[model samples]
Target: MTRLRLAGLLLTAAPLALALPAAGQAQPAPNRTLRVAPHADLRTLDPVFGSIVITRMHGLMIYETLFAWDSKLQPHPQMVESVSTSEDGLAWRFRLRDGLRFHDGQTVTTRDVIASLKRWMARDTVGLKLAEYTAGLEAEDERSFTLKLRKPTGMVPFALGSAVGQIPVIMRESDAATDPMKPVTETIGSGPFRFNRAEWRSGARVVYDRNADYVPRAEPADGLAGGRVVKLDRVEWTIMPDPATAAAALQTGEIDIWEQPGQDLIPVLSRSRDVRVERYSSLPNQGMLRPNHLYPPFNDPRARLALAYATDQADFLAAGFGDEQWWKRCGSYFVCGSPNGTEAGAAPYAKPDLETARRLLAESGYKGEKLVLNSSYDIAPIGRMAEVAAESLKKIGMNVEVQFADWGTVTTRQQNRNPVDQGGWNLFVTTASGATMQSPITNIGTNMACERAWAGWPCDAEAERLRNAVVEAVDEPARKAATEALHRRLAEVQPYRVLGQYDQPYARRVNISGVLEAPVMVFWNIEKK
Candidate 1:
């Protein structure tokens, strides 16, 4: 698993002078404003339309969920005041928390909540499944709503409060009414912070101002739940693609926090007494290689299988993370170290077999068609994974063409469903939070609902049936059995290949406090002292 040259492949530090601010640019206020170097720039503002983590983070900044997960991953009411379930668990009633208002001063209503859920259902994997069981979702009054289910299930609150994938955020009815497939340009929400759209610069910076009218919950802050007290007046995200430049900024106190510093740059940051590196969540980040199932080569199961045989999890983990202490070669479709993380069907492709890969490629009837591999050079780990995958694919006698771009551009281009000649993509490498992959229901990669599936769009009826089994199981033992069956189905279907798992540690200044531990990054509780 260890590569001799892996350490050298990691990012090397650049001179601290490279991170100096432009002349005449205003400096960030000492304790009032907190400037952060985000891993990627803000491109997609519509949370429902984009499945990227950055978009989810943006959504959390200005939008609130009905329920949210605490640090322990337990569902707790956030925007909802209370929920009551029927004896059969088929019917549920929800009451909205008082004083909830959009940024425009409009009161939050059942109309908005229902519309937002409908929009979210059209996109989110869990929401899609929830819609299947929903008999009716109607408003009882302005602040209350009722959800009648066709069958009994206990996944309602968990699905609504999901912290990973595309979150079910409450938006204005007008914004939620916009087609789920299209982007909602307006950023109006009733969360703790308001997006400063006028101050946003695409590739450079983004700003958010504390929502003065926001009423924090009476409870103490915990993960994405409880009170979201805004201690700082403003939060600014400074896009720094280069790890070296970000490290320099953190060391010089130019940036209050660096969301994800490259593994190689950790030493550079550790040397600075002012900067502290820490893991935000206990769950590891799992890497994945998603193939366009609609396309020719990948559309064939054998071709996809060829990818599985050729993929070396060790190569990916070593290349992307460099440090063996930080990453592991995980074969689980569900994240390794998680409850349902079993390697049931992973035995066949546990190790790379170039001979088997070539055989599978031949059986798939693939000629010499070029496979477009979309990759991002802006993010270190993703870029390394792409490089390793391209090399592995070429070894299997596949025509692999790597298309390099910034993370934001790669994310946008991946949405294209056209042929490669018409700007479509064949494959792309990305990572999901381990928290999202802990179960069959939460993991978006396991979705095989054809058109409704995530970007890759891999459809398998058996996989869908198996996932439903896991969702419908009555107890832990039954659920585990169903999950293992689903995991086996996923391995055979090869919807998305799990490369490996690694911890992504965040670095911040010592003065920063109150950073909550959650699956994804949120800006509400942190304060710069």
Candidate 2:
């Protein structure tokens, strides 16, 4: 079951020991503080520790990657100004922007990048997705570097586009090798936001100031440059998990913004004249559903497949949330509109067929045994989903037991001990970040193949084999064949059950500005509307 380690975090309303009295109708905005209610706080600030997507989104504030994803979702240069690969496609050269500087006053250099990339390759399996594509990288000049691949792999840059691939911050090699957790506590990057301070107990309310020295500009000839700059002087993410309490604080002007209010409260919050609810499209998969590979029953693919029969995904859409628009459909792992996704359709793995499910239950050695469901996310929606699924599974002869988990219990990658491994719940549901961008390598590496992460089911050789073929096969037809084969196998094995993707909800005061669909809400874009 998915654990939302910080979902229930309370938005404690302490008396404004430091309060600025509200003026009549409108007030001039000083630097603003937005109180967002993330279902779970991020597991760690260590980008290398968690999923690439989480790290990359976090990196936007404290670090910079080589490439960036454009509004159209195509790859564009970021740190590196212009890149040219060898005609053989085995070697590539990058011309880094000159004069890029870190918040620590260190000018960005090629040596820093080589050190950072080596560090990421050492620990981050997701980052290794890029490693698998390239043999090695060497610094050429103060602003130039070269990457040598094993073969004519044109997909190198495209592959980096996967989660953290879009951005790889170059760090001083000496500094990176010194700290196991680099850039988290003491970090340096050439991005817009500079990390100030972070403490976990006070609920991870990190303070970040702007990186004023960053001077990477896109020339008109190069076609992409001058990213939207940070407009705010100070940004703080106050830890808040309880939706109602967060909404209450936002209403009273305690914080400038919050996000993902419960459906029940959407109406009540929407009626407030002082606030604005901004919704953006989420990734293609509904929240991720992990069937316990550690548990004996779930170890069997038949059991996993039968479990899929328990939930009526169609009904989940109708009743998944109070706001129908919040639950939407996605075609593939990458966001629906990217280069990898196909047309959306009903998930074959989610169709509810009690008779077939009953047969699977019998074959999987369950006459009516108690099966525990583990979850740490918002109980309302998942509880609703479970209740419906329980009734359906009952028709197929399963004694399913429902239980609760602290939303933050799952691996935040900040620390160890995954809740799915300890909670004994057979099913875990939560949103998976970053892998959706595409690097056939990053997309499937850990989500399904990494044995350490999925304890119950050791790494599947065939899964990796199929996935690798897709990533390495330069020929389009072969790549398609490999990907299609993997999906068909996934449907049969049921490693994960997708409910369908949903929307991202950002609730801010009417005067607050700068809400983009980016995974992490950008602070620089914020100003009073």
Best by TM-score: 1
Per-model TM values vs. the true structure: 0.93, 0.78
Give model 1's TM-score versus the native structure.
Answer: 0.93
Candidate 1 residue-wise lDDT, 424-474, digit = tens: 999999999988887788788889999998888988999999988877777
Name the TM-score of candidate 2.
0.78
lDDT of each: 0.85, 0.56
